[model samples]
Target: MKHVTYADKALFLDDDSADWLMEYARALGSATMTDTVTLRGIGMDGNEVEATFLLNHSTELITQTTQSGLQGPKNDEAVGYMQEQTRLILTPPPARSVDDPLEIS
Candidate 1:
């Protein structure tokens, strides 16, 4: 499990979830954008719960491994989505040509 500290709140998430969240935050910062994301994680009581975070250029997120005996929540789909979003931000698609053959007159 990993601990993600944002502002004054800390959330315990799985390794992938925490790592991808950090990377996505960096990408969002580079793009000068803002977004809200929620991921399943271990709450203060060691039970599974959803934690939300706001990512933006001025926001900061920290992650670190934890030795808690509780198993972290598995959020593969959310992790994948965040990874893809980060990729898109870091490597955006090429712009379409205005004079392309497919353009309608």
Candidate 2:
């Protein structure tokens, strides 16, 4: 199975920048990928947050297994493994309110 891991830290930015990161994550989740991808989770600091994504192996096979329960879908497992590791370092958080600034900000 293919594996992809990444991390982000955006605690230095102001509230606006943090919000943008959240939007960016949403966009990324829907973004296209040749392999099966899963959103692990995100860490938040006031308006800032860190996100992670994992690309697993036999994504198409897994999807087919989940949907059809049939094997041998052209054996594109290696292709999935060749996927690039992706990470995004965000600056200038989005426009949003940070509740309990003392804890996160």
Predicted candidate 1 versus true structure: per-residue lDDT over 10-62, tens digit per residue: 87998889999999999999899998888998877667788888999998788
Residue 23 Cα positional deviation in candidate 1, in Å, after optimal superposition = 0.1
Q: How do all models score by TM-score?
A: 0.87, 0.23
lDDT of each: 0.87, 0.28
Superposition TM-score, candidate 1 onto the true structure: 0.87
Kindly report which residue stretches of model 1 are placed more than 4 angstroms away from their true locations once superposed: 98-105
The candidate that wins on TM-score is 1
- Which residue pairs show backbone clashes in model 2? 1-57, 2-57, 16-93, 16-94, 17-92, 17-93, 17-94, 18-93, 20-94
Where in model 2 is the C-alpha error above 4 Å?
A: 1-10, 33-105
